[model samples]
Target: MQILIVGGGTGGTILGNSLARRLANEIRAGKVRITLLSASDKHMYQPGLLYVAFGQMTPDQLYRDEASLLESSIDFHVDPVTEFHLDRNEVKTGSGKTYAYDLLVIATGARIVPQEVPGMAEGSENFYTEEGALRLHKRLMEFRGGTVAMVVSLPHKCPVAPIEAMFLLHDFFKARNIRDKVKLQYNYPVNHVHATANVARWAKPEFDKAGIEYETLFNVREVDPVKKIVYSEEGTECKYDLLIAIPPHRGMEMVETNNLGLGGWIPTDRFKLTMNDHDNVYVIGDATNIPVSKTGSAAHFEAEVASDNIVSVIKTGVPVREYDGRVYCFIEAGFDRATHNAFDYINLPELKPPTKSVHWFKVAYNQMYWSTVRGLL
Candidate 1:
């Protein structure tokens, strides 16, 4: 059997590692082969980008060699996928390499599209990329005091990231003793501040205490770089000296080019995590159009379910496991405090107040994530 996993991000890496370990005996006997495809050699710890923007972490700290994280039994291919031929069960890469597989997992993840919003590329400082985070770090360091608007362009990966960035900025300004001079505001397109109503309710008090003004139902329609103003289609306007914007996110070009996505996201069976039109093809992580948090924890949970089901289908010709839509996130509330939220499709997330220990746990998790990839945690 030949197994091919695309995109060496968190979902792909975890699933590859899990399957490699589970099928070790078959791999050793040369009865099964596993291959992973990645666009780059470096695997980024994406959640740490917020810390990078806050100057709490460097880029090097969040990156590891993609090939090093996988088991020896799994083959790693460092190349960008140009086309996905689902009809033929073949993948073509930029280097003109073609791969055929019995089972395919699409974990290509989300792509940030700053160009979708007018003047966003020219005016706003994005924290979603490494260069953007480092640029924001420098800009934040030089900022004396002014209005800082944190705008969300569209539904994005890591739904809590904008909230976390806003909270951390408050702490950053407060530490510099410029909190009074700097005004913090958040604008989101959603009806509520967060995906979960209860989580949003729980976060309100924290924002209130920190003096962070939040506006829901404010979708950014355009940004004027020269005027330093953001306009919402709802006729709302905000002026800012510094704009930290979360741009629109969509599925990868490979999926889009292949017409595998519905509205730029791969349409999948929400519980089974399998592609809607193809039974042998699975979708996980940020690529899927499932109603989940789109966080690393969600991907990790999805990987677990996908890996188990793949193994079962290979052995018995049937997938016996199903994904639960589980999602976990640590809301960084600044001031060395954080809150943990966990929930699934059927369960509402319980609200836990921020704590100093939970913040430490988040820090520790960043380090432990690599171990988890190695199947050590």
Candidate 2:
């Protein structure tokens, strides 16, 4: 049997490593073959991008070679997938290579397209990518102090990152003794600041204490780069000296090109993590149209369930595991302190108040993630 896993990010890497260890006997006996396909060899620790923007972490510290993180038993392909032929159970890559598999796992993650909004690509800065983070870092250093508007374009990963960015910017300006000269504001599309209502309630006081302004239901219509104004569809406008924008997100191109689902997302069973009509294929992470936060922790949890189901199906033609749409995130609240949130589809997040120790835990988690990818944790 041959297994093809597309994507080498957190979810793909974790699933590949776990399966290699679990199917070692089958791999040795030539009964199963696992191959991982990724567009780039560099595996980025996406959670640390915010720190990179603040000059708290370097890009080198947050990335690793994708192939190095996997075991020798799995095949690694550093090529972009161009098309998905689900009916034929085959995938074509940019290099013109076609791989056929008995079982396929789609973890090809989301992409941000700033061009979706007029003038956004030219007017704003974002920290979702390494280059974007580094660019924002340089811009922040050169800033003399003015209005900084952090805007979310909706359906982006790391729901708490915009909040974290606001808090950090507040502390960053204060440290320079120019806090009064700078104004920090956050604008999001939703009616609440966070997905979990209770967490938002808890965070309101923190925003008040920090003197950061929060606006909700602010759907971005367009940006005026020359005027430094962001116009909302709801007839509101915000002017900024520096705009930090989170672009609109969508699934990989392969999903749309193949007509898998609307808006390039795969329609998966929320609990089973299986494709709508393809029982042998599974979709996880940001590629699926689930009502959960697009987060690394969500992908990590999905990986465990997907891996078990794959193994069970290969062994007994049955899948027993189900995914629970759980999401976990650590919110960095400046001043060397952090808070955490844990929730699932049916429950409100249980939040841990900000503490210095929790900040250290977020720091340690960056290292722990590397270990986890190597199957050591």
Candidate 3:
């Protein structure tokens, strides 16, 4: 059996490593093979981008060689898949090589499209990518003291990231002794500050106490870079000296080109983690249209479930276990205080008060993520 895992993001890396160890004997005995195809030779620690925006972490610390994180038995390639022949259980890569597999895992992640929003690409700042993080950091440093407005859109990766950014903005100004000079403005598309009820409940009062102004149900319509104003779909507007946006996201273009899913998000079984009509094919992470946050923790949990089922099917001809929409996220509430949330499909996350210990744990996890991708954590 040939197992082809596409996109070397968090989910693909973990699944490939897990399968390599579990099927080590099968691979050596010429019964099974595992291969991973990625767009680049590097693996990025995405969560570290948040810290980069705050100057707490450097861009160099966020990357590792993709080959260095994988097991020796797994075949890895830097050739990105340009076409998916799902019906034939095959994929064509940039190098014009066709890989046929008995089973396929698509963990191709999502991308931010600030260009989708009118004037957003030119007017707003973001930290979703390395370049964006560096640019936002530079903009933040050059900022003297004025209104820094945060605008958010839906279906983006890391649901709690905007809240964390807001907290960081508040603390950033405070650290510079210009908290009173800078007016931090926050806008959300939903009725609450956050889509998660518990998170909204926890952060609303915190924003109030910190003097950060907020406007709910304010979907971004467009921005006027010349006038320095952002208009919302609700007919509301906010003027700012600087704007930070959590832009909208969509699954990879290759997924859309293949007509596998709408908006590039493949139709996937929430429990089985399989494509809607393709049992031998699995989709996880930002590629699946599952009702879960597109965070690394969700990807990690789904990869484990999917890899376990793959191993079971190969060993005993029956699959075991199911994904429960589990996700865990750490929120940086201040420079030295942080909190986290853990939840699954059946349960809602109950947030705790922020503490310095949690902050340190988050910092430590930044390094441990390397071990995580290797399926060692």
Number of the predicted model whose lDDT against the real structure is largest: 3
Residue pairs with colliding backbones in model 2 are none
Please give the CA lDDT of all the candidate structures: 0.90, 0.90, 0.95
- Cα-based TM-score, every candidate: 0.98, 0.98, 0.99
Candidate 1 per-residue C-alpha lDDT over 1-377 given as tens digits, one digit per residue, 9 for 90 to 100? 99999989999999999999999988999888999999999999998888999989999999999989999889998988888888999999999999999889989999899999999999999888999999999999999999999998777888788888889999999999999999999998878887678988987787899999988989999999999999999999999999999999988877788888765699999999999989889999999999887788888999999999988887787888789878888989895999988899899999788999999999999899899877678
Instruction: Report how far residue 46 has shifted in candidate 2, in Å.
Output: 0.9
Show where candidate 2 strays beyond 4 Å. none
For every candidate in turn, the CA RMSD to the true structure comes to: 1.1, 1.1, 0.6
Candidate 3 lDDT score relative to the true structure? 0.95
Model 1 spans with C-alpha error above 4 angstroms: none
TM-score (C-alpha, index-matched) for candidate 3: 0.99
For model 3, the stretches where C-alpha displacement exceeds 4 angstroms are: none
Give the per-residue lDDT digits (tens) of candidate 3, residues 1-377. Answer: 99999989999999999999999999999999999999999999999998999999999999999999999999999999999998899999999999999999999999998998999999999999999999999999889999999999877999999999999999988998888899999999999999999999999999999999999999999999999999999999999999999998999998888898998999999999999989999998999999899999999999999999999999999999999989999999989999999999999999999999999999999999999999989
Screening candidate 3 with a backbone cut-off below 3 angstroms (N, C-alpha, C), the clashing residue pairs are: none
Cα lDDT, model 1, residue 109: 92
